[model samples]
Target: MGGKVLVFGGLRGSAEPRPVPLGDLVVLDPATLEVERVVSGGGGPALSHHGSVPLHDRWLLVVGGWDGRRRLSALHAYDLAGAGGWARLEEEEGGGSRAPHAGLSGHTCTKVSDREGGVRTQRRFASLDTLHVDAAARRYWRNPPNPGRSDEPKGNGRGLIERLSSLIASGSASPRTPRALRHHSMTLVGPFAVLDGGECFNKASDTVCNDLFIYDTRTAGGRWYQLSGTDSEMKRVGHRVLVVGENLCLIGGRGPDGTSCSPEIYTLEINT
Candidate 1:
């Protein structure tokens, strides 16, 4: 919201997707094109596919993502007003700080409520009340009108392989849940979170998918609708999507052909 841009952990630039974890907190001056290191400790969370959102006037919250070997569930807060550094969210439990969920990466968390404030993280929709999420895989069930957070126990929620293993064990052998995506962007649109094109490796098909979907935050029934509009035929990944007035502007991304990057810019006129 200021002149400076706050950059969190992300993968190194590459044409093809590779696991390159970067945990540096950087501040960039758009006008001057200067860079500054914000995290001075050991380092920021060395993670990729993580999602960050502005917490308060002076803070930004970095949530779930991959940490090289495994997915991480630790909640980290970066101080923007004070000396910029990373700090984990500690809750008083038995005179000690207990850890939060550490099972997801490549997830998205958005501030859905202002009066009863909370951050909604995805992979599977879960409601945890204490500003701390414990049950990493609460599944997308019908929640109440008013969301109440859950205080489940600490556990490594199921990953893609694990879930698939379970389905195979049960003889169902079907892909039920949506695949995890990387290099994606989600923009808050009124009561909806508009998620545009990103890269997702479909283990079932062994192919990459570049699709768009939208989630309505106000609904008790957690549901996502696939969005297909103008230029939706063009498969795009790692692109920039922004809400401009009544239209959603989609900028450059990896083209569907996979040989080159997309140079064309397109926008979908929001009917609402």
Candidate 2:
């Protein structure tokens, strides 16, 4: 079942803030060129730079975002089954509190399907994979590699590794730390998550990366790789990375200097 594509509350830096915390929800019907807005209601305070996911039966799960004054971690749900209105979801303990945690830009949340008689079915589903920038914490958190199910080598080392081993042996799981990422884009490709170009905050040179990294969820290991692209283009942030077939389409985003980059699209072929 397909629904509308609605975008709200993202703007170039210099542009005046949209009069409201949440911008108009732009709705587009997939089968036609028709587009319109449905007023969203009761979703707490207005929010920008937030993360939204379409839940079962046309409900939207709205998470943390910046609301001008401060960052928010309050969870709200919007029902799209009829007249849309927002409802709150209780947050897990130690989860991002009311802090601006990267505002969900460039992250991906995928609905996991259940299997029945060897066929995949999209029933009422929940996200098994979630990626976030966690700007406030300055790191990334992924679902912990399933213990007793993962095949990654439990290596031995003198310092941090040994401490980690002790923690695991005592049945204490490591709390997921946010990764060191800023202005990066992540998309799920099969069992792997691919991260694309964005600046890495380096105090020495303040370098921005045009590099690529792939995190294998199954293996719980990540490796960095470089991409071949022209340097004339400005460094991008808050861009949309959409998976269309086997190609990853890099769509519009703002540059490092807070200027909106000219509308440009790049497609990267994934080697499956």
Candidate 3:
């Protein structure tokens, strides 16, 4: 919420197959363009494509991803306002057999709250596919229980609902959300979330996409609509996107060639 940016697990390299998944947690000062801190205490090996959700003002919950060798469904919590360390999120109230499902990677999870002072999670993305050829899946989970802190959201590692489709069309004329989006980046802006570039398997789509799509969660039936009128169609993968006031800023990623790195950056002005 301040001038800081939090970065979690990701891969570091220009080529594919195995690009060195990273497990370090990093915080950066965007204004100075410098890294302020780095912590490496998460409960697992190095990972990439993990989803993280802010639990509240006090903590952040890091969820499933691929840990280099295998897809991981491990959960870890990081204390932002207190002693900085990682605590593994167990499956049961008193801890039980087998951890929470770890087969989720390349997914998107956002923090959502209700008027009754309860917070839950909303997630949508393709499951972990080394080839990026799986169908996009939507899922939701209720907060577990009270976590001692009045403001902390509890998660018991159960109650996951799968909504197979989120690509509902508003009308036959309305453009549907882009398909074959696995490695995309999404930024929450108010009631809408904007999804940017990502890659698909060469056999499935044979290309990376630079298209932009918007998901509206304000109404009864939420759907994804393709955003039009952008002159720059820059295909990319493994990119980062963030909201700066009313504008959306896109940073570095692999370019159209798939293997080449893109040094150029672009910004899209949002009228909303």
Best by lDDT: 3
The lDDT for every candidate, in the order shown, is: 0.53, 0.44, 0.55
Supply candidate 3's per-residue lDDT for 131: 13
Cα lDDT over the full model 3: 0.55
Candidate 2 residue-wise lDDT, 151-201, digit = tens: 121231123223323433454432332235555666544444455655555
Model 2 residue runs over 4 Å out of place are: 1-4, 12-21, 29-45, 92-179, 203-209, 218-228, 231-234, 261-272
What TM-score would every model get versus the actual structure?
Answer: 0.58, 0.57, 0.68
Residue 43, model 1: lDDT of 50
Superior candidate under lDDT, 2 versus 3: 3
RMSD of each: 12.0, 12.9, 9.8
User: Is candidate 2 or 3 superior in TM-score?
Assistant: 3
Better of 1 and 3 by TM-score: 3
lDDT of 3 at 263: 52
